[model samples]
Target: MSERKVRVIVAKPGLDGHDRGAKVVARALRDAGMEVIYTGLRQTPEQIVQTAIQEDADAIGISILSGAHEYYFGRIIELLKERKASDILVFGGGVIPEDDVPKLKAMGAGAIFGPGTPTSVCIDWLNSAVREKWARETA
Candidate 1:
């Protein structure tokens, strides 16, 4: 079988209208050689997870700045679990509180990126994480 590029879904959830960060991250991820599907603005958790599954995404990156990280990320994780899509690596960024990082991680978020995060840092982490998962699955 031929090798496939890592597919990622970048989504913006809730009533937050700020998408500049999401767009930036999407572009960065795309430039890093991953297939990115941006779910646009104001997506529900269910919609985001559904899109990820439909797109057969290997990873999901959510950008949220509405201070509802817990609810949004938690709901997304729960939905992914319910759908048995937990194998898909999930991450969150944008104004996340440092204190909540452990909580979100415990709920299945692979990582949380806060403001001023270097794009390369996230890109490298994603590449490594996806590569490792793919290797494990294909092994």
Candidate 2:
């Protein structure tokens, strides 16, 4: 039987107007054989989480370059937990500082790929992490 392709919801939260990086990552994920849903910029936390649920996505990746990663991600995590969607892997990327990455992860973020991270690296991490999460869920 063929393996099920991971479905990911790539969203841009907040007022961050720049989406070049988000687009790049989305394309890379599509190329990596995952089904990617790229939600355009200016999405609120609720919209993103709702979309993830509606899409039945295995992962939610938010791209925030507006320096409000902490607030946005925090709210997203809270909503996910409230909606019992914590099993959905939550990851993000953008101009986040190295120091903030750990804090983000500590708050339920799976991974934070900083600016300039190779697309391949992000893709690989997502693939492996999603597989692990999927296996754990099924088991």
Cα lDDT tens digits, model 1, 1-139, are: 9668989999999999999999999999889888999899999998999999999999999999999999998999999999998999999799987999999999989999999999999999999999998998899
Off by over 4 Å in 2: none
Segments of candidate 1 deviating more than 4 angstroms? none
lDDT of 2 by residue, 18-118 (tens): 99989999999999999999889899999999999999899999898889999999999999999999999999999999999889999999999987899
RMSD of 1: 1.1
What clash pairs does model 2 have?
Answer: none
Task: In angstroms, give how far residue 122 of model 1 lies from its true place.
Answer: 0.3
Go through the candidates in order and give each one's C-alpha lDDT. 0.93, 0.93
Error (Å) of candidate 2 at residue 3 is 3.4
Q: TM-score of predicted model 2?
A: 0.96
Superposed by TM-score, candidate 2 places the C-alpha of residue 40 at a distance from the truth, in angstroms, of: 0.7
